[model samples]
Target: MKSQCKSVVTIIVGAMFLFAGMGFCQEGSEGKGGSAEWTKVIDSKVSEKIGDKGLVNFEEGYIEAVGIGAPPEQFYGKPQARPMALRAAQVDAYRNLLETVQGVQIDSATTVKDFVVESDVINAKVSGLVKGAAVMNKTYLSDGTVEVTVRMPLSGLAKAVIPQAIADDKKTDMKEHKPVPFSKKPAPADEVYTGLVIDARGFQARPAISPKIFDENGAEVYGTLIVKREYAIQQGISGYARDLTSAQSNPRVTDNPITVKAISAEGVGKTDFKISNEDAKNIRAAKQNLTFLQKCRVMIVLD
Candidate 1:
């Protein structure tokens, strides 16, 4: 009887250990699985900050799009005829109209401006009279009051009539969410902040001026000139990242942003050239569209 009791106790203890081992294995698998990859992806040097900064963990997020009403053509007709002339005219008219009626109550103003008539062209008849596009201006005051000014084309009166009516109906729906006025003092905690919006679109990053920098051909350059500029991430975004972490964990966010400074082109003659504003704009646009995946990889090194 004594031997049998000891055998039973041994079996019970072995079973408990087996169960515990299985549980630990399951936990280990989970810890090494899917979510672990997210950490690694973020940890890679391309996106990571150097020198013990906090890691960035992304929460599941959603992008919500709020439509500020489509342009008139999309509302009325098919988008098959989006020629540049028409688009240009549309934008020009919209801007002009906004300026003309700056402070009028949108619902109460009932004036009209004339641009070109699309219907005449649509009907295959040439109406020699130049028809201008209608205009409407809306203003919102500091006290959450809204004002509107409208200029309807003679032929557009029909279309114009409905918008003001809709505006009238939706007046109550406008919530009082105006931004707080600018202050000499710091904003209260809950305000959204934006860093200085530099129009660096075409602005190439140049090396900061250094007193003792030299150029190619072994000539001592008096001031620091832009050498080579790799691409750089936005400062505001990286600054936010730096603020998120402290020194306690494996890493924390750093206060400084990573930048790619320009380098000098060795042995190249100083060629002074001027590009047109339009060309500069195009260059900026092109640069903005350049692939950022490579930048992400480079940032991983910093991480």
Candidate 2:
């Protein structure tokens, strides 16, 4: 009877090992074959966050305007309460998204630079990326919308490590191996210099790239400096910019108006004063003066 009992125990232990190995094998198979399903985890998290916050919207990597307009003459610095909320929400969203993505390799990360925010228009930038695969060569994606670049190789330690890291505690093991930080282009701000008192804000431009202007009294202004620099749009074609002088003078001039002016003395690319499409044709049809990239100082109120 004792001998038979020992034999039964041996069989039970063997069965346990067999089941454990099978479970591991299944997990491996799922990781290898379920790329689409695995990536959905990221999408779901992002969507959930957006739904919770009605003022913020995101599709794939593009952030849409969802919040209400800012109060008139509101000061612009780093970001107001709304942008702070968005930033925090975005980070949490991405963190949750990463938790769901198994076997995703982050090769590099950099802050998207050169964002300009004058009044309320936020021209924020995103990061760019390059992906490497075991089979295919490399894939490139623009960081202009998203903040991360991911690489997925068919076979390698990254694949195995991804599953292990996630299953263990939804942790990323590549924190130490992250790539270099990407610098974004400086954006426009809301400060303007009157050569006497620096204004806290001009209008809402791309506040991210806009710098704070200071008077000799050390008072901070929310306008931008008229610095001369090479301005390139995302596409290297049709380098056109509308002026913001007339529009700034009359904040309520039009819902959308195409105005142009050089904000600086050195003669760089002028700010693009964009209006609605309907008004665009009217303005152009009337032979209204449009400011392209190189047009200098038609009108700029420093004070």
Candidate 3:
């Protein structure tokens, strides 16, 4: 009877090992399939990010951010996992957007953080700005990853942020200025023109929350608040250019152009003025004479 009992135990142990081996084989096959699926999903998602011709349209005056999310292991197999992942991705996208906007570059060797600390008020404003941003695209990958793209028009964003920043800093008093019609002024000389061009080559000249044009005496001739609200919204910039041809393409351009070289930039945060002593006298003369320059188109050529 003892010998028979040993034989039975041996058979049971052998069967157990056989079953374990079969389980491992099945698991290995499933893992291989899962890895293949993961690769396909990743490839497709990357292609989507690149878009046609592998280029993403980050047009001037528009800020865009992309985010990705995947469900955690604990949430996997749950009915709510897909939706939760998507929501998490959207939140991630907004956080990225905030970081992009808040990460302001101060100079070649420094950034905004070197000059000022971020406060709760600034965080809240950034949150509001993200909430108002427009949704650009959304995608789901077979590997359980969700992706989202969001964008905010700089024109609208500036209208909201600039005034608040100025109010908080109390650095400059923002007043409204009415533009006189170009028809009111007499024709300019051969050298004088209706439109304004600023040559900012050999230096960094970027878009800001509030950008202004100043004369040599430090008087403001053109600024964010000076332009009509509709015009600002439509143009989305005081002006920007890399060269004369590009400057001419600006919506603010005209047949004749008055050119100037930028001397310096000043003010706190993203709100500043680009000063030009070279054309300051001309700008003052134009303003004093109530020339068409008051309503003329302007462009800035940057390096």
lDDT of 1 by residue, 1-303 (tens): 345333333443343333321211221132221222434544431222112211122111100000011225433344433222233333333232322322111121222111112122311111111112221232223332222221222222222322222333235322321111122343333422211111111222111101111222232211111111221211111111111122111121222211221132221211111223332222223221112211211111111
TM-score of each: 0.14, 0.15, 0.57
**Could you say which candidate leads in TM-score?**
3
**In candidate 3, what are the lDDT values of residues 187-253, reduced to their tens digit?**
4565556577767555444444445665555556665434444444445435565566667655576
Candidate order by decreasing TM-score: 3, 2, 1
Per residue, candidate 2 scores C-alpha lDDT tens digits across 39-60 of 4533332211223211111112
Off by over 4 Å in 2: 1-208, 223-245, 249-303
User: What's the true lDDT of residue 269 in model 3?
Assistant: 35
How well does candidate 2 match the true structure in TM-score terms?
A: 0.15
Q: What is the model-wide C-alpha lDDT for candidate 3?
A: 0.48
